[model samples]
Target: MRILLALLYVSLVGAPGGSSLPANDSFRNTIQSILNIGQITLFHIKKLRTKLPAAPQMEFSTPSIDGLTSISRDLQILDNELQNPVTDLLSQIQADVSSMEGRVRLFALTMGCPVQARPRGHPWASLFPDSHFYLILEKVQRYLDTIFLNKDKLKVC
Candidate 1:
C-alpha cells in the first residue's frame, strides 16, 4: 500500500494546476487507481513466484522487461505534461500498458501460474485481484478512454 500511496502522490504532484480542472482531477484520480491496481497485480505475481518450490526455472524475455520500462517512462512524461495533454499520447500509452500486461499474462501462463478473479472487499480494493493482471490493464485502458480519450468530444487537458 505504501507503493500505491507514493505513486499516487507522485502522479498528483506531477499533474498540472493541482486540481484546477475537474477533468484533470478526474484523470489524476483514475491514474492513481490504475497504479494501485497494477501494484496488486504485481504483488500477486511476486507472491506466486516466491511460492514456487525451486523458482520453477523459466526464461522471460529481456525485451519484455525493457518494453515495460520504456512504457512506464513515457507514461510518467505524459503525466507530467498533462497541462497540454494529447489524446493520442494517452491512447498509445494505454495500448502499450495493455500489451505489456498481455506479455506478463503469457509469461505467467507458460510458467503455470494461475490467474484468479478479484476477491470481495471495498469497491476500490476490489478493483483488481492478485492474478487478474489483464483485468487491471483493461480497467486502466477503459478509464483512460472514458476520462481522457472521449471520442465524442475532445478534452483539452
Candidate 2:
C-alpha cells in the first residue's frame, strides 16, 4: 500500500545511502507502529462489541498470506459502523503489516531461514468467532515483535 511505499521511500531516498538509523532500530520502530495501529483497532472493536455484542468478526482463510487479500474487503464492510478513527486506524494497519511482513521475508531469505507453515483455520476461528480478528492481530504483533527484537527468534522464519 501507499503507506508502506512512502515509508520505504523515506528510508531509502530521504536518508544518506538509504538509512540513517541502524537496521534494528528502524525495524523496531516499524514494528512498534504496526502494533500501535492494531491496538487501537482492537480497542475500537472491543468498544463496539461491548455496545453491540453482535459486532462482526473478520475471518482470514487458511494460509494467511493468501487470505490477506480478504482483509480490505472485510474492513470495508465494517467501515460505516466503525467510522473515522477506527476505520482510519484499521486502514493504516494493513499497509504497515504488509511492509513488515515483506521485511521479514527478505530477512529470512537473506539469512537462509526456513519457511514456517502458515497457521491454519479451525478451532481458533470457529471457537472465537467474535474475537478472531483480535486474536489474529495479537498473534501478528507478537510474531513481528519477537522476530524484530531477537534475531535468534527469527525462529519466526
Candidate 1 lDDT over residue span 1-157, tens digit each: 9999999999988776655597556645644554544555444444544543433233322211222233333333322322112223233333444443444343334334543332223222333233233333333434334423332111111
* Candidate 2 residue pairs in clash (backbone atoms < 3 Å): none
Q: Per-model C-alpha lDDT, please?
A: 0.38, 0.43
Instruction: Please tell me which predicted candidate would have the highest lDDT against the true structure.
Output: 2
Q: What are the clashing pairs of model 1?
A: none
lDDT of 1 at 156: 16
Candidate number of the best TM-score: 2
**For candidate 2, lDDT tens digit of each residue in 58-149?**
54442122222232222222232222232343444445454444544444554466444433322222344336445445444443344334
**TM-score of model 2 (CA atoms):** 0.32
Error of 1 at 44 (Å): 0.9
